[model samples]
Target: MRDVSLLAGVSRMTVTRVFIRPDHVLPETRERVQRAVLELGYVPDRAAGSLATQRSGFVGLVLPTLSNGNFAAMVEGLTEALRTAGYELLIGYTSYSVAEEERQVHTVLSRRPEALVLAASAHSATMRRQVAQACIPVVEVAELPDDPIGHVIGFSNYAIGRAAGDFLAGLGHKRIAAIGASSDGERRDLRGEARLHGFTDALLAAKLPADMVRMEGDIPFSFTEGARIMARLLDEAAPPDAVFAVSDLAAVGVLMECRRRNIDVPHDMSLLGFGDFEIGQQMVPALSTIAVDFDDLGRRTGELVAELLQHDDPSGIARTDVGFTLIPRGTTRASVP
Candidate 1:
């Protein structure tokens, strides 16, 4: 910073002001400083700046996993939004474990971030308390919480599940099976559970026997897991007429497996999935699934964090429900006799 300031013919304070409040500096002076910074490849010490101002200008982002395209997209959207606001994102992956999430939270909080954005609904009461004590803006993205720590900018997983189940039942799929993530690490499991309950109840209400319902697990909400479960079910003497995989990745796997086995989708079996990721549509037979507005989720989270940061009174809580839609495509069809 000192070298850049010298090269730009400005004081160190001028350079600092350029970053913190560029609007205060003359256009020519700002340009000269920026050019000097570029020429010298000099990076300002954001940490030092934070110490001086007590504002980190950084937002801590904690996600359950980067493996899922859905979460990855959400992160991308979030980072883009944060960057536009002149804030940097400090990211951490927790692999969906509450303990791991708590540990990551502690590590991120140590950095004194201006705000925090969590990908999943937190499970640990201790962790929740810790975040509250941090006294920073905390926003939970992707899934709605029963008790949000600060602000929420996501949808109800329960509603997504129920919607998927209702759509499948309305299509007259009497014997429905659900393939879901078996890991207890993520609150996403609650989505699978809710979908399962909704599917079963909807079927039962239609006079379909509860015994007709089949479920399989030991998956991590991926395409590979979905395919594996479908293979196991197909190997059985009586396969389900329709199956709902909790994730689009899993549904794609199911579709691939059916193709390999020469099983006709919506003819021999129907499939439904969640997330409605891009891959779902690119497949040979497009997936029928529940779609969450991940981009909206990201934007809303950013807005909520900004609100919490600017407000003196934290008493007002904002819960934005980014709703879900069921995309009916080629995968699910009317049951065949």
Candidate 2:
């Protein structure tokens, strides 16, 4: 900064103002300072600036996994939004473990983030305490909580599942099966559970045969697990006419399994998935799914962060419901049998 200041024939404070508050500096001086900075290849030290301003200029984002396309898109959207506001995103993954998520929260918070975004609504007691004590604005994504510790930006997980059930049921499929991620006490599938609950509740409400809805799967939501559980279901005396998979990964797995066994999809069995993964859309039978606009969720989350930081008012916006959509594709059809 000193070297750039000297080259620009300006004081160190003027150089600082140019980088931190360019709008306050004269346009010609700003241009001169920028040229000096570029010539000297001088980079402003964020750590030093943070100490003086008491702002880290960073927003933390904690998500489950990078492998999930929906999460990736969310990250992209959030990054773009924050970049527009002169903030960077610090990202960490918890792998869906409550303890790990708690650890990640502490780790990210240690960097002194201005705000934080979490994908999971469920948290360990320690995690909750950490978030409360951090004193930073928090935004929970994925599902809106009944009692939010901070702000929330998401849709109803249960409602999406219920929509799935209604869509399948409306197609005249009496025998419907749901494949879900089995919860490990430590890494519970809260969203999956809610979705399954909604799906089952909708089925019951529709007067669908009690025996027609079969719940299965103790594995995580993955393509391999989808295949494994689907193969198991196929061995049963009476195979389901349609299956609702907790995720597109698992749904595609089921579709692959059907191909392996030469079981006709939709003709013999229909398939539906959640999350609307990209690959699902290009499959031989495009997957029907419960679609959450994750990119939009991320954008809204970033907007909330910007809003809180600029106003220093966490309560300015309490909740944002991005909502979800049920997309029916080729994989799901009106029951022909």
The candidate scoring highest on TM-score is 2
Q: Which 10 successive residues of model 1 have the least lDDT summed?
A: 210-219
Residue-level lDDT tens digits of model 1 in 1-337: 8898899999999999998988899999999999999999988788788888888898999887777777777877777777777787899987667788889998999999989888655458888888889888888777777877767788877677667667777777766777776654443355566666766676666676555343556535777888888888788776777888778888899899999999998777888888888999988778888888787678667766766777767776778888888888888775445
* Tens-digit per-residue lDDT, 4-77, candidate 2: 98999999999999878888999999999999999999988999998998888899999877778999999999
In angstroms, the error of model 1 at 6 is: 2.7
TM-scores of the models, in the given order? Answer: 0.92, 0.95
Each candidate's lDDT (Cα)? 0.78, 0.86
Candidate 2 clash pair list: none
Best by lDDT: 2
- Please give the RMSD of candidate 1 to the true structure: 2.3
Instruction: Please count the clashing residue pairs in each candidate, in the order shown.
Output: 1, 0
Give per-residue lDDT, candidate 2, residue 281. 90
Those runs of model 1 whose alpha carbons end farther than 4 Å from true positions after fitting are 184-188, 210-215, 334-337
